[model samples]
Target chain A: MAGYLNLLLRLTIWFLLTADLSWDNLLLGVTIAVLLPRGATNPGTLKDWLYTLGEVVAAIPQAYKEAFEIMIYPHHHEAITLERAKPRRTPSLLFLDIFLITFTPKTIVQHYCEQGWYEVHRIQRRPTP
Target chain B: MINILSDGCMIIGLVFWFWGTWPLLGQRSVLYKLHSLSVADTLGSMAIVMGLLLRIPHEWPLLLLALISLAIWNTVLGYVLAYCSTREIGHDG
Candidate 1:
């Protein structure tokens, strides 16, 4: 299931890259999408992948809201915090989580520690001293 | 209606560009700047592309590709940039 999801993603990219809907294009795209080397993804279920995808989509509006909040507000207090990862999260999902965190305006995962904590830097609106 | 909407999107996108980029001139940490840049810039570019997509729906394949790459790559690029700069700091200090 994960493999099929990867293929679908690749094929979609292929189609958009080719910008053609011809029968021959379809065949070649499928072939290439299938033949591409797979990355070393830790064992993760398809459900997890889909949930991550859903979160990615959901973050778009959230990103915009954060952007606006940052723009409208006064100076913010920045902080660095160590965040714990979900138990047994695959590397792929971990990467996605980092992406989700960093995609927003207020937080970024500065470093991923071998001890499994994310070194996060964040900004929050606080009253000026 | 479409014309107005597309123009509005582009306008909003331009605002985002300036909002995101204005911080580069300020005294701030790299990661802090990166946060604004990735979020606002990516969303801004996507908004402009969306405007274009609405204007010329025929060129959608290319524009769609542009949107996807902008969304995914820019966010990842922020991480990469942050990773590199922070590593340099760790090495020195």
Candidate 2:
């Protein structure tokens, strides 16, 4: 039930973004939304999706702050290796994680290894320690 | 009042766009330059779009699409460019 609803919502947003209420465009949006790969069998409830959206919105200020810091100071490049420990890594969750992390100017995912590790490149001022 | 806010956003966006370029001329690695460029470009573009959105509220649908595209495609492009550079280096060595 939730999956279908989610699909409908996405389709609606797609239509709005296109600003075309024509039948053909509406059908196309529905087709594309249906054809796209969904995350998991049971993605999540609407509340969960709303929570995630809120988190993303809250992070915007932090992203802007980091961008300003990088611009103002000399930053050194470093790669932070990370391992994904989650047993069930949903595609949607992974995509969201990558998008949020990269949205910030301070860090970007450089590589994702098949061996379950991610090479994230970050820029920061040299530590005083 | 709205005009003032929109102009402020546009000016800040332009500043960010120009700020990103300064690293290119410095003694930084390709990755560093790419990092600065992508970050500034994304934020600056988004800011400019926001300004436009405020100025022309009626055309928000297109502007919103532009913002989404900037967020998604810019990050993907950065990853692709970095990956290609690494592959090229591996080939040479």
Candidate 3:
């Protein structure tokens, strides 16, 4: 099945990244790859993987833009509260979102507010249209 | 040539590390300080690891792991700290 293949691919990558060909290390990586994806509410398909990869690639430039903005204009602090339009976000997606936003220096999610709104603290407020 | 590139990456990483810290001295809110520190820390650490990756290509496995860990754990820690602070404020007031 697709899921099994995905798991195998991830395990292989993990093995390479760890660069340890020992039995113990290989066992650990296999255990993790098998166990973790099983917990995902929706296991990733090839399309999903490709889409996420594209999103990450696109985000690189945006991240750099935000980082430069933070470095150049570091004096101001603006609190912008926004609602999560989506009905629900998976833990994985939420964590990914947080990591992506926080990786850039401009914004940080301070608190998950009532009514599905998130209190995001920002360095610069968006301009009014 | 490789040494020069590695040194350059390390120097740039140090610059990012300092840039992230310079905001801490300011009278910013807790969230603001956390944001600056986390961003700088993550990027700087990754850059340093990248320099190491370049300096010793054979050790990339370890350096890559370091980079990935820095990205994941640093962001998670920031979120945890922010959540705790919010909870404390809610409890008191």
Candidate 4:
């Protein structure tokens, strides 16, 4: 039920943002058809789900901080501390991904390695960019 | 006002297009070409819509609805088309 609701909400948001009835109707019908069989994926009850949401809320800040450090605004001094920090072979995608991640509020890419591993860090905002 | 902005945007969109279209200059894969074209179309249409918005005075609601619909359709169609082309061509990344 929760998953169904989540899908519905997502689809509605997509519909509004995009304003395409064809895409919106197709996606909505598909979501309903698929979700009817599987129901929900949570192993726990509703209360447990709520608690997990709380945990996720707490983790967001740390994730954003980590992401920022890894991908977006890394300290040059810290780069010295981290000796393994070599240039990435795929700089274009890495840079683009970081820019996209950091462009959003409360998210930052952190600890970006040449191996394409990234950690996301989150932080609270005070309105001024 | 919207007309002027739209015209400016259209000009910029054309610049992206000219750079993206050439085989020799871009040397980009089919997928990248599609992506660039998608960007160009979106930006170009935005400018055209801006011009329409300025010129058409009334019916703001309908105009906006049409604009949003067109943009969404364009994006989804371009993405799917490009994806299909890239898959067929077997371009790596």
Best by DockQ: 1
Over the stretch A14-102, how does candidate 3's per-residue lDDT look in tens digits?
Answer: 97677888999988998898777464354445554455557755665575566666777654646656747334554444556666665
Least well predicted 10-residue stretch by lDDT in candidate 3 chain B: B38-47
TM-score of chain B of each: 0.94, 0.89, 0.88, 0.63
Query: Which runs of model 4 end up more than 4 angstroms from their true locations?
Result: A1-129, B1-28, B90-93
Task: Compute each candidate's TM-score over C-alphas.
Answer: 0.93, 0.80, 0.78, 0.37
Is 1 or 3 the stronger prediction by DockQ? Answer: 1
lDDT tens digits, residue span A1-129, model 1: 677777888999998888998999999999998788998655688888888899999999999888888888854688778999877887778889999988887888889987789998888787434
Candidates, DockQ: 0.78, 0.60, 0.60, 0.05
Best by lDDT, which number?
1
Positional deviation of residue B53's Cα in model 4 after best superposition, in angstroms: 0.8
Choose 2 or 4, whichever is better by DockQ. 2
On TM-score, the candidate that comes out on top is 1
Residue A127 shift from truth in candidate 1, angstroms: 7.4
Better of 2 and 4 by TM-score: 2
Candidate 3 per-residue lDDT, tens place, B1-93, comes to 999999987887788789888879989777878867865787777778888899999887677777777877887788778778877877998
Q: For model 2, how does the per-residue alpha-carbon lDDT over B1-93 read when each residue is reduced to its tens digit? A: 999899998888888889887779999777788778876788888888899889999898888888878877887777777777766866898
Q: Residue by residue across B1-93, what tens digits does model 1's lDDT show?
A: 999999999999999998888888899988878877875679899999999999999989899999999987888898889889999999998
Off by over 4 Å in 1: A127-129
lDDT of each: 0.86, 0.75, 0.70, 0.46
Which scores greater on TM-score, model 2 or model 3?
Answer: 2
Cα miss at A45, model 3 (Å)?
A: 6.0
